[model samples]
Target: MSTRRTLLAGSTAALGLAAGAAHAAPSVTAPQPAAAPGGRPPNLVVVLADDLGYGELGAYGQKLIATPRLDGFPAEGLQFTDAYSTAAVCAPSRGSLLTGLHAGHATVRANPSSGARVP
Candidate 1:
């Protein structure tokens, strides 16, 4: 209905599709190095919901919003209670995340969703 809900729904659907595809698709990308006693490396799933508070999910402590799927992550996987971000906005923060550089050292200090090189 609303813009926020629409965006969230779309993002949620994309996430589900990506997860399903990763599991169903054949391994035709790369020859990953074997891990000790483990064939492949562990998969890391990062969900960055813009403007979502830490307590918004049921995993945390939100009574209003029912997030059963997300709540299960703590038991099945990892749940980070605290996290640090270089930027408050998504684009800049994600830029720093992918580059592993703090906001001060990163070139994309602002939201540049165009994926264009900044000079």
Candidate 2:
């Protein structure tokens, strides 16, 4: 198999294991936002990192990393321990996340090379 394929496979397996571990933990209820005035939607922010390990964050029990702000997120926001990415690779994962679909259902599955033409 190609290096990219191998890496994707490994990442998928690792993420699956992490998800299982998260599933074993107790669930937490997310706090709901207050209704906006004039029926306007509330602002939302999502932070995503590539190739970040679960144990690298202070909130996830990393004593070495000084993530004070991130550590405090649980107090004011909902934290999901069992969350998962739809794909092992960036392009596919992002597509699945945006579309709310799994890898099998997502339209884009892999990142094509710069010179590769995509339809």
Candidate 3:
């Protein structure tokens, strides 16, 4: 009688495991949105300033520079308050801009001499 009871208990546990495996829940996934029709990327423009502090612009709270022309730019364009250049000097920074790389990865690390002419 005890042997029969053990067999029945084992069979019931096996059946429960099989049922759980058979009735496993399907995975839910978020639906992907449709792509844009044109397949073209958005336009972008980058502006760099030399020897200019952030507060020197009227948009940045400068009152004495008389920056009327540049004041309206922030309203029409995207302005970044926390943006920084790759380099403190102009040459490496310009090199990074032209090459689409940071100063550490730029090929030209320093400004060329004034006597050195580009052919």
Candidate 4:
């Protein structure tokens, strides 16, 4: 299997987060809603920027921009000190988000202006 496929398969099984199993939208009627009595997996929101630098946000060293949302989020939640993208450019950066693959394994590396299709 390709590296991207391998990474995705490994991550899904390790995390116990199944894929392709039809799930209802969040509602009270859903079966076994939310985690059990014990602590459950925290919601994950993976935000990726195409070319945004580490110092691009107000929380970072960007002095001019006023990013209230980004700055205030750390107060409510944890802020990671070291975060990086899968690639330095756009296309591969997006591929990582879709397939959960690393930059080295991304087939759609570089700018990829040739219109790539997602599986």
Whole-model lDDT per candidate = 0.71, 0.68, 0.67, 0.66
lDDT tens readout by residue for model 3, 24-76: 65553332334556765345445667778889988998887788767777878
lDDT of 4: 0.66
Instruction: For candidate 4, write residues 1-119 as lDDT tens digits.
Output: 46656857766664453332345444423223257457674465666656777787777678998878777767677676886677777777787878777777767777746666544
Query: Which prediction has the highest lDDT against the true structure?
Result: 1
90 Cα displacement, candidate 2 (Å) = 2.4
Candidate 1 clashes between residue pairs 3 or more apart in a chain or in different chains: none
Per-candidate TM vs. native?
0.54, 0.49, 0.52, 0.57
How high a TM-score does candidate 3 get? Answer: 0.52
By TM-score, the best candidate is: 4
Clashing pairs in 3: none
Worst 10 residues of 1 by lDDT: 27-36
Cα lDDT of model 1 by residue, 14-112, tens digit: 667666766775742333334746666555467867667789998888999898888898868778888777788877777766666668877877876
